[model samples]
Target: MVCLRCVMVVKEELNKLGYHYISVVLGEAEVIEDISAGQHEQLRTALLKSGLELMDDKKSILIQKIKNVIIELVHHSEDPLTVNFSEYLSQQLHYDYTYLANLFSEVQGTTIEKFLIAHKIERVKELLVYNELNLTEIAYRMHYSSVAHLSAQFKKVTGLTPSHFKQLKDKRRSMLDEM
Candidate 1:
């Protein structure tokens, strides 16, 4: 689950099932009651019907958590991190950055850096489409060193310059989940 609507769907399904939840954050939830095996299956089925999955595997859950953290950082957070991403993820997830990076690469078949870059680029596309901030402000918000760096990364990823992309009518940005 990467969006608020996804959280609402989960909360709705849980409420219908008569389960009380403390909170339903991006990738995980905390329920007030202990869930039985039957209840687990039922919840999984309900979430599946609404296009969500109940992840069981520890590694998969960790990967999902990583994705969710990145999504939150890029899409939700107004301020960019003061520390580097490696340190930030390590602090947030309570695991070594190397281990997380390796597991992410093994399971997702891509480096964490690539995944982050893709999401960051998507966020840039979004900012451009909004037309609220200029390129320099965008660079600062997205944590790029300079406008040239942002433009180069944007062009490399999207095959178009930022100005050109903004000018085009079809301004497409990927969903958080898709990234």
Candidate 2:
């Protein structure tokens, strides 16, 4: 689960199966009761029906948690981090940065940094489409060091400078849900 609606679907499915959950966060839930195999299967089926899957493997769960954390920070959170993303992720996940970086690259076929840049650029695209924030403000909100850096990255990823991209007036920004 990566969004509030996803959490709601999971919670509703658990309730439907007569299971009690203490809390449901991005990629995890705290259950208040043990569920039978049949109930577990039912819950899994219900989640699958809603386009979610039950993560049973430890590594997969950890990876999901990592992705959720990144997604939340990049696309959802408004408060900027005081530290760099790598350090923040290391502390949040309680793993060495190198280990997490290697695992992410090995499993996702791209570095975590690249994933972050892609998401950030996507967010910039959304902001540009909204036309609510100027380029400098968008760069600051997205934690870029400067507008030039943001423009360079936006151009690198999308093959168009931010100003040029914004001028098109016909470009559609892809949502995180579709990514």
Best candidate (score: lDDT): 1
Please write out the lDDT profile of model 2 over residues 117-159, one tens digit for every residue: 9889988999988999999889888989999999899989999
- Relative to the unseen true structure, what is the C-alpha lDDT of residue 98 in candidate 2, on a scale of 0 to 100? 93
**Sliding window of 10 residues with minimal summed lDDT for model 2:** 169-178
Q: Where does candidate 2 stray beyond 4 Å?
A: 170-179
Instruction: Give the whole-model CA lDDT for all candidates, comma-separated.
Output: 0.93, 0.87
TM-score of each: 0.92, 0.91
Superposed on all Cα atoms, the candidates' RMSDs to the truth, in angstroms, are: 5.6, 5.0
Residue-wise C-alpha lDDT for candidate 1, range 1-179, written one tens digit per residue: 99999999999999999999999999898999999999999999999999999999999999999999999998888887889999999999999999999999999999999999999999999998888999999999998989999999999999999999987734344443356
lDDT comparing candidate 1 with the true structure = 0.93
- Between which residue pairs do clashes occur in model 1? none
Identify the candidate with maximal TM-score: 1
lDDT of candidate 2 at residue 113, scale 0 to 100: 94
| Model 2 lDDT, residue 127, Cα | 93
